[model samples]
Target: MKQITILVPDGQSTLSSVACIVGAYEVLMSANAYWKDVGRDEPFNIILAGVSKKAAFDNGLLTVKTQANIADISQTHLIIIPSLIRDFQEATKGNKLLRDWIAQQYQNGAELASMCTGTFMLASAGLLDGKNCATHWSAADTFRNLFPKVKLQPEKLITDENGIYTNGGGYSFLNLMIYLVEKYYDRQTAIYCSKIFQIEIDRQSQSAFTIFTGQKLHGDEMVQQAQAYIESQLHEKISVEDLSARFAVGRRNFDRRFIKATGNTPLEYTQRVKIESAKKALETTRKNINEVMYEVGYADIKAFREVFRKITGMSPLEYRAKYNKEAIV
Candidate 1:
């Protein structure tokens, strides 16, 4: 049987960490038994490994008993890392030992998989330094700031490098587990587990769920002014030249600084802001497509539709139908 060890952070475990590790064991165990009863081979030896013999979760509301301390398991086929709470930094302060253990396991030929913010731990362990990884879209800025070398693909629901795997934010971890089940066992078994768990299988992107908030946390005053001006003028056509002149900065310098600070060029940022506004209006109000486009300062219907689709991966009418039934016409 393949040794599939689920690593829970003993220092500061989240409920998700406890739940994901345990849930995987339950689902995989069910799959193994189902396969065996149906005359198939058992595929996994599920092990719950922790940094300590027991770990407390949710400020000591619950304590989990680990099957083995991480040090006891010198070798395994795969190591699963569950996400901490929203802030990876909060739990990582006392997690050096856990991080080192993870790195050592990877070096010892064990594959790695992380869920949501758990990718932070993997990144911290330097396993994701030069790999493409997925995390919560909300953490895109911080993740980019901390690990510039790692290609952060927040839109992707899962990323598979040589043996290192990462997934997008939140409950999407269930889908990641299903993906692994398909890989290690069979697609039919994964489908069986998906039905049992009521998890939608083969969900590939988190982009549709992302609401672009216009990142302005980089502490660039000039860029912030430009962003504020763009947002305030949502009903007006915004040009980079106008913004540069208003900010008293040269066009090239403004473009460079804007991209550096916001991770988007001036035009791209304005388009995102406008599209986000259009999305909200579609979600919350009763407005036709053309009316909404005009309200957001896009006079050309084709341009507005293309920009909305480019950012959201769907047309305006489709977005409205998906998000708001009352507004659907």
Candidate 2:
């Protein structure tokens, strides 16, 4: 049996924190059952291993009864880092023992997968130092700021490289789980679990679902002002030169400071703000695609569609039809 260890970090976590571990456990168990029905032996020996045998989440609403602690198990086939709901720094800070165990496990040939903000923990373990990983879109800037050595692919629903895997934020964990199922079992078994669990097995990008919220917590007053002005004038063509002049900073200095604060260039930030507005419009308003584009300050149809697709991985109409139930009808 493949020893699959799910590391349950002790802390307050998102609503899905406990659920994801249980979900992965149940799915693997179900896969084992499927193997039995098909006259095959079980594949996974799943364990809930952590620093302690018991980890309480959500203020003791749920207490996970882990069978093994980090020291109890010397090695395993896989280590899953569940999502942490709190601040990444604080969350990782409290789990140094668990983090060290994770690093040791990966070094010993055990593959690692982090779900949602669980990427924060894996990053803390220094497993993602030079590797590309996926996390929630909202946390992209923060992840970049904290772990600049790691490549952050916030748009991908799942990223699998070497022995590490990371899924995008939230319920996208299901997609990553299904992906692992496919790799561990067979494609046919993965299809069965996807049907049983009602998970989209082929989803690759979370960009369409992400509503781009610009990072403003960098604490630079001038940079924050530039951000606010650009957001305030989403419909107008605001140039970097204009923002620099208005903010009383030099052109190169403004560019440097803006990037330092926001992890995005001024022009990229402006485009995102405009696109975020367009996304909201597409989701809630009854405006046509072109109307939505023009409302977001994109007068050229080709440019608008291209930019939308580049950022969102979907066209405006596609995003609308996918998200807006009324639009579908």
Q: Against the true structure, whose lDDT is highest?
A: 2
Q: Write the per-residue lDDT of candidate 1 for residues 1-329, one digit (tens) a residue.
A: 67999886875557877777777788778789779988988878888888778888888988878899887887899888888776668767767888899899889899998988888898887888888999988888888877778988877999999899898977888889999998878999999999999999998888778878877778999999899899999999988999999999999999999988887899999998999999999999998898899989999999999998888888998999999988764
Candidate 1 residue pairs in clash (backbone atoms < 3 Å) = none
Scored against the true structure, residue 169 in model 2 reaches a CA lDDT of: 72
Q: How well is each residue in 117-180 modelled by candidate 2, as lDDT tens digits?
A: 9999889888899999999888888898899899888789999999999999788888888899
TM agreement with the true structure for every prediction: 0.93, 0.93
What overall lDDT, based on C-alpha atoms, would model 2 receive against the true structure? 0.87
Q: Cα RMSD for candidate 2?
A: 1.9
Worst 10 residues of 2 by lDDT: 7-16
